[model samples]
Target chain A: MTMLPPPTSKKLGLVIDLDICVGCHACAVACKEWNDGGQFGPLPDANPYGAEPLGVWFNRVHTYEIEPKEKGAPAMTVHFPRSCLHCETPDCVTVCPTGASYKRAEDGIVLVDEDKCIGCKLCSWACPYGAREYSEQRGTMQKCTLCVDRIYNESFEEIDRQPACVMACPTRARHFGDLGDADSAVSKLVAERGGYDLMPEMGYKPVNKYLPPRPRRDGCAAEPTPAQEEKVDFSTSPLLRWIDKVLSR
Target chain B: MRPAFSVIFFTVMSGCGYGLLFLFGLALAFNPAVSGRIEGLVQLGVGAIFVVAGLLASTLHLGQPQRAWRAFSQWRSSWLSREGVASVASFMPMVLIAGCLWRGADATTLRALGALLAAFAAITVICTAGIYTSLKAIPAWHNRFVLPGYLLMALLGGAAWSWLIGEWTGGARAQPALIVALAIASCVLKHFYWRHIDAATPASTIETATGLGRFGRVRSVEAPHTEENYLTHEMGFQLARKHGKRLRNIALLLLGPCTIVLALLAITFQAPLHWPAACCAFAAAILVTAGLFVERWLFFAQAKHVVMLYYGGARMHDA
Candidate 1:
């Protein structure tokens, strides 16, 4: 049975603007908030105050620093927020020992039905991205639902019916729309900005797009700029004075 | 993967079941037995229970259960296929040998047939292990240690199960010897396998796994997919090095020493204690078996498969 609309109905997905993302983690928190309170119910924490704190989370933002290839350039920090790509292939669904996990062929969104899950943890083993997390108490697999509840809810305006993470993005780094439709906003953004996916060769065919970090201007840190030089306190700064003395001596 | 009851039962039952009858066939060949004329028919009857039941349990793992029969056709290439065929074929001589033993006659031809059946049964156990050990794609399984280790596992499992049977049979003579050999063999192989894996380096590094040239620092930059891919699902396995190390130590401590103790007990004690000692031997076997399952899981998890190369993991050498 088709629980979701087909690929033609502007199959919406996440388009993350890696350049604009400030590593704020607002999207992740908002996801937890909406998903926790919404139709999926609580995402469940094993021990919120325990020694080994582990539970389910759909979105996790990782921070990484990229050093310039050329000498004398400052490193740039980039934030990567990961979630289910709702891949075209969706290996998690195909490999499920029980049919609890499946993909909506129409829009290419992967989901766990939760009813048939025997708490096998097999799906978690199959996921390379570590996307699927085991719910200890409930004995089921939990993952990014692509905010299924909000996207189709008619209670709100048409445009606002997007995922919580995209809606909550403070820097406007996150965009939600269909890539299956060529003219969709997400597709256009992807075309204009060259969005990439995580570990493409693994071939899950993730629908979520990650816009690569925009190249920063070179020589940002080499031979301090005149503005930086003027800002530097020459005489009173012990570090500078000591260096100068050492050179003179 | 959780250790399913069916598999645990099958591995233990089949291994020792085959081991016992195989030994019976061997003893018959060597003329080493002092008493109890080789009851080929009865041995065949008992062997059928182990072989059939174990095979049935193995089928429970298959998604398409009916296709299991088709597994036998691949004997030319697949070890799994070879295992199926070997297991099935071992039954033929077994039945023939049983017929001979039941005639209340000592036929020279029947002894040769019985030995062949026992030999096939033992080979089937090895082939069952070869199914896992042959997968070169999985570095943990691809290792040289896997072949011997799995054979040793089958032997140990067989010995333990046979001990239980021996205990039930009012303390049989050869059970102790079988237990000692299997225990020592299994424990030693496990320790060696653990040490080998522990000392090994990742076949490839994150940079090389991605096929990115050496020297340039490579980070995820951004992951290519969101939901789990097959490579990550299959190869991104992690035994969490520390936990793997800890479990390995536990296996060594429990299985190794207990194997020795059980052997000594079997040598020293004669009756009720022998039965309990057999039970204890199996208890150690159970622990080792469970540990091996964890070890197998870690084997897959920590393997960092060649496919994980694209996911920014390194490739490893077989050695």
Candidate 2:
């Protein structure tokens, strides 16, 4: 039963823009908050007040400092938000032995059936992205559901009906829509921004795409200043003159 | 890649068990007159105990041991499921062979049943090896060498156990020699396996990981979480080079040359009722078990998972 469903025409996924992201952990926190009490609620935190604490979370944000490759190149910070990409050829699903892990035929959202999962943790090993989280307390594996319960909810306004991470992004850097549709807003964003796949060489064919930060402008370039030999330039400023007088004494 | 005690015990103990059963079945088929019925029963009983104890040890790692039966359902795609099914199925032929021995069946009939039992035993070991070999995510495990290493170790361990039985019952002179040859082969194969892994490179890098190759060198300034999480705890084990090297030396010295020498000594100078041979065989088993334990620990400790790229380590590149 862990056999993957046939490729769905509707690959609903998220498109994350790196340029506007401010490295705020709102997405990760929002994901935890919503999922904690939502479909996969109560992401337990073991030894919450102890010296060493651990918990299960569906999303995480990592920050990287891209150092200058050249002598005077300007550096940049990239805040990467990671979750399950809902891959087309997810090894997590295929490696599962109890039919506990599976992908949906309609939405392409990969999910783990807590009831059937034996907590063998093989699926966790198969995932290269480290997206699968095992709950030691519940004895089941949990992962990013892409907010399935809220995305299709008819009671909520269409504008509010999206992944908690996307809705909570202050900069609107995270966009959610049908990625399979060429004309969808998310697909258009991907096309215009040259969105790329993370670990494409891994061959998982991740449904989610990430838009790389735009090229830094000339103003941000680190141009080396010429060394000047001139001295005694502070003669006109009284504060500098007083400091110079004190230093001369 | 954290080496859980349960898994270590399972692989080592079960491997010896399967190996012993394989040799016992082969002995019954080719040389029924080599030993008496009592010795055969003892061999089968020991094999069964090791295999069962190993299987039980494996279940200890599972979060829900009550639902362990569900693992047997996905043999078509999962090597683990196949192993579960194969191990259970193997019990049938083993029990039948034991019944034949108990009834003092004719040599020809026992030989046929023995061959069937041996085939089942070999298949079960292959399935066990396949469980680790088939994992593509862990490059350290996914390889041709893993299967051969496993097969050879099982054969060697089984031969050693059979030698002990033969020595006790005054069975055959060729048996200890066969065990010595297998021990030598297994040690050589294990060394090669270690060398191959030591020289291997990373399968993926941070540049490829984030699709930021065009940008300047990518390096982590901050992790996603401050405290350790399940992923880090499970896959982020790091080993010092000095400790790893020392452990490897111990394993090689004890399991390889020491065991081989002990086994050879037992065979070279035979005594009445083979008492000296039996003592040497017992010593060899203890040495190999202790040596392989260290070797198996190093196997997990030294492996660097691709997930470690997110943590701090050497950069990975696209395959």
Candidate 3:
């Protein structure tokens, strides 16, 4: 039962744009909030108010500073959101000793059947993305389900049925749809933005794609004027001069 | 990469057990009259105890210990599952061989059962090695050196155990020359393995992990969380170079020169039932086991998982 399912035509995944992300951590919080009480309820925190708190989370956001290639050019800060890629040939599924980890053929969604999991933690070791989270309290492995319960729920409106992370993005940096479909909006976005996979050499063939940050045009290479380089001068403004005199008196 | 005590104990103890089983079976097949019935039973009993204790220790590593039986169901794909199956299957032949020894069976019957037992034991050890080799996420484990390292170490430890048991039971003695040779081979293999990992360049880096290499030199400015999470807790263990080198020296000394010297001393005292020979062999066995424990700890502690790249690790090797 740990055997991977045949490749599916419907490779539903997410496409994130790095240019607009502000590192607000709203998406990660949304994912945790939705999953905590949803189908995968009670993402237990070991120490809520203690010095060291550990818990399971399906998504995380990391910030990286990219040094500019040209000297004197300002560096760029990119906020990267990390989560499960739902790979085509995931070793995490095949490495399971118990038939706990599996991928669905219908939509290419990888999931862990908690009931069958022995909590061996092999699947966690096999994952290069660090997506799988083990719950000590429940004695089971948990991972990003891509919001399986909400994605297909008929009761919710079509617009509200996407993943919680996508739904909560303030800047519309995240998009979700069937990546397998060439003409889909998400696929078009990927093609236009030149979206790329993380660690492609690993050969997992990750379904999720990330759009690179756009080039900056803030004239970072321009030289500063002599006046700009000088220390604080009240001579440029009368209000600042009056305030400085009053303070000195 | 946390080097859990339960896992280290399981691998080291079980590997020694399988090695002892293999040697015992080979002895039974080649010379059925190597020892009396009681002596044979005692040898088999010790091996069984080590194997059973190791298996029990492994269950402690699982969160759902009661559901450990479910692991045997996925042999079609998983090496861990295959290991479970092979280990359990090996007990069948072991029990049969034990029964044959107990009844004082004929040489022909004992030979066939002995061979079967040895084959099962060897297969189980191979399955154990396969578990680490199959993992691609940890480049340190996914290497050519790991497979042979596991095999040679198991045999070396087994040879040491055999020498001690032979002395204790006054049965067919495992050649001291053979133990010396195995110890040398294991030392050489470990040296190469360590050198290989040290010099090898990591396949993945933080730049590639974020797919932002085109921008410039990418470095993590902030982590996902301030405190240690599961990923950091499990994979963030960093063994300092100074400590690692010292431990490696200790392991090599105990496993190589010291063990070889003891084995040579045992060989020098050629007289049968000599107390000095027995003492030397016993010391060699203890040293080998202790040495392997340090080696196993290094194996887990030094492995850098690729996932660390996302959490500010510059490269896989650096992590």
Best by TM-score: 3
Per-residue lDDT of model 2, residues A165-235, tens digit only: 99999999999989999999999999999998887767889999999999888757755578996578786
- Runs of candidate 2 exceeding 4 Å displacement: A224-249, B31-35, B106-109, B169-174, B240-242, B316-319
> Candidate 2 clashing pairs?
A36-A41, A36-A42, B204-B316, B205-B316, B205-B317
Ranking by DockQ: 3, 2, 1
Locate the minimum summed-lDDT window of 10 residues in model 1 chain B. Answer: B207-216
The prediction achieving the highest lDDT against the true structure is 3
Please give the interface root mean square deviation for model 2, in Å: 1.2
Writing each residue's lDDT as its tens digit, candidate 3 over A1-249 gives 889888899999999999999999999999999999889777898996899989999999999998877778888999999999999989999989999899999999999888899988999999989999888888889999999988998999999999999999999999999999999999999999999998888888999999999888776557764565546689989999999889779
Where does model 2 sit among the CAPRI classes? medium
Q: For model 3, what share of native contacts is present? A: 0.86
Model 3 chain A weakest 10-residue run by lDDT: A223-232
Over B1-319, each residue of candidate 2 has an lDDT whose tens digit, in order, gives 7888888888888888888888877777897765576777788888889899999999988888888899988887777888888888878878887787788778888788778778888888898888777666677777778888777777777777667766666553226667667767877887788777776765577777777768878888889998999998987766534487788889888777887788778767776555777788888777877776787787776665667676642553221
Top model number, DockQ: 3
Descending-lDDT candidate ranking: 3, 2, 1
Taking the tens digit of each residue's C-alpha lDDT, what string does model 3 give over B67-114? 999999999999999999999998987888788878778988888877
Interface RMSD of each: 9.6, 1.2, 0.9
TM-score for each model: 0.59, 0.91, 0.94
